[model samples]
Target: MRLFVTLNFLPCSVFPSPSFPYTTQEEESGVIANHLTKHFSSSCYLSTFLLLIMSQRTLLIPLSSFFIAHLLISGAVSTTFTLTNKCGYTVWPGILSNADAPALSTTGFALQKGESKTITAPASWGGRLWGRTYCSQDSTGKFSCLTGDCGSGKLECSGTGAAPPATLAEFKLDGYGGMDYFDVSLVDGYNLPLLVVPQGGSGQNCTSTGCVVDLNDACPSELKVTSTGGESVACKSACEAFRSPQYCCNGAYGTPDTCKPSSYSEIFKNACPRAYSYAYDDKTSTFTCASADYQITFCPGPNTSQKASQETNSENTDTNTNTPLINSTMVYEGALSQNGASPSLYGSVLGSHVTAAIVSFTVAIWQWRQLF
Candidate 1:
């Protein structure tokens, strides 16, 4: 997803409160006219000043609406992320918030076969979510997964990204252009098949993106993550397998021109055409929408329709009770969050600076008119 971080001015002086009838400019102008007419008794000056006040008032309505519209639009809207596990076995979903961003409720949670869980992401939240396969908890409460284990040794990721060879669903909200960007990324690697679908959003290329192919079954021997039973559990990225500049796309080979897709990434790209195969794969993999909820499904293929009996688990998760089917989806309501606009979109960077200037200008007009 596109990451957007901007600092812009809030037009506080432009938008007056409902209780205050006149806008800042109009109020200042009226006060000045009243003072000048009362003290100096300057009828001609008062007439000219009132005319200017009338002109300013005429512009207030449309300008007020414009600023108000922007204010509403710029405010952050909560987005829902619904995670479903369609695999035959249980899957533990791991969440890692971006550095310095607020964490979602329960960084790690379990979903039985065909079960789903929902989480509300606040505004401008950037994070990655991945499923852990074949997880087991010891008597000491130390949990570990054969695939996508974040090394936390517990269900909670605790603000840690998944290890290599794990399929990842990444997102950043209120991104550049005021759109939410999301994508299924294999830049790290692939464990289970997954998909990210946008719901009720408007924009180009807001379509679903995922890797339906079971890369583990077809993983190359050199990049295979094997289980205790000697079966391939996940497919490791070339960078993780080789740690070379060509595979990792680092240093001298960081540029797109220098770091062309290797045979391994090409395999991933071929399997998942709409997912990120390499570090530079942005144009095709990245998807954006203005405001939309998303469904992230693991193992989202033909066999996904099969439902296994829900097993008794001791984890406390708000299971998707509305639907008994494994493939059913749920939407959650989130609180409103406000995001700042890019200064480049307008001219000012600091909202306080703009407010100060407007207040100063208004005071100057008030004082000058009172002196007359």
Candidate 2:
């Protein structure tokens, strides 16, 4: 007795809809089937045909087992990363997959000003991305860069991570609870202004985050990395400069309770509150999203960085206060408001103080008249 079982599945085109969204379970299954059909041997297809010729009870057991195994083997949703360069000069972007995660197609590539590139990562892929500035080839055809070089002496970073003093965008996709965790880190130090914006995702903290300011302009004298022309290229962290256990968050200061933010770290925090200023900055730095693609932009715009530089300098004038130089919640359209107080907020505070003074004066006049 021949038993025929027909499996009905939606077409791949139906996926990525507004309601259904990207990386849904059905879409993953369909993608797996499509991939197998194109790559599987003809003998494999013949075996499936022969299985259909068996009896109803015998066919059901083996067919169900075969499908279950296929789904288990290739059932992960892929994520796409879009990298764009808005800097005036060319940027060589590098990618480094985490120890356990698989490598991507191209580990590193060049992106000219106003250019963009997209790369796809398999499910559960985790890695870091950064831009290499001042890259060039010498007489021997050896490649290298001034900042954020992976030390591979080649275009592709392969498995090597970016050297310190590079602004990094780190990601762990399809993480806990099927959510993606990402952060723009200045912990390793800041070389360029980087921003990570999630596309078509939903979460409370899924908003944009990064160091939009040009730290090189406002970088402290001790932590500044200068080029051959004496121009500041990158800013080094206190940990990188001093190599102390306290600044590195090691030894006695290993735990969060033990290690605390220092004056140097506060400088970075005051300038870019959304970025990871030090090793232990997690509360406000880390962001999460679900089923989304990410757009990583280097030097989002020129005006944003210029305004941030002015604010940072203004804040540095007064170092006695504990209050943050930048309002943590203040959001300007395209730039960061790093001032300790916004103009509107400052006006409100001043108005309240003036009213209190007038009330005291009126009471004093009344008392003097009564005494007379």
In terms of lDDT, the best-performing candidate is: 2
Best by TM-score: 2
Candidate 1, residue 135: Cα displacement in angstroms equals 0.5
lDDT of 1 at 126: 73
Tens digit per residue, CA lDDT, model 2, 108-168? 9998767999999987678788988878878888888888888888999877877778888
Off by over 4 Å in 2: 1-76, 304-372
Q: lDDT by residue for model 1 over 1-372, one digit each (tens)?
A: 222212233333233212211111111122211101111110000001111233233211123323433434444357898998877668889998766458898899888878999999987677788988878888999988878888888789886667777888877776544556677888788888787878766555556788765666567899998876676778888888887877776667756777778889988887678888877776677776656888888867654322221334543232223322221121212212223321222232133345434544454355335534
RMSD of each: 18.2, 22.9
Clashes of 1: 2
Residue 142 CA displacement from its true place in model 1, Å: 0.8
Error of 2 at 153 (Å): 0.6
lDDT of each: 0.62, 0.63
Regions more than 4 Å wrong, model 1: 1-71, 304-372
Backbone clash pairs for candidate 1 read: 76-337, 76-338
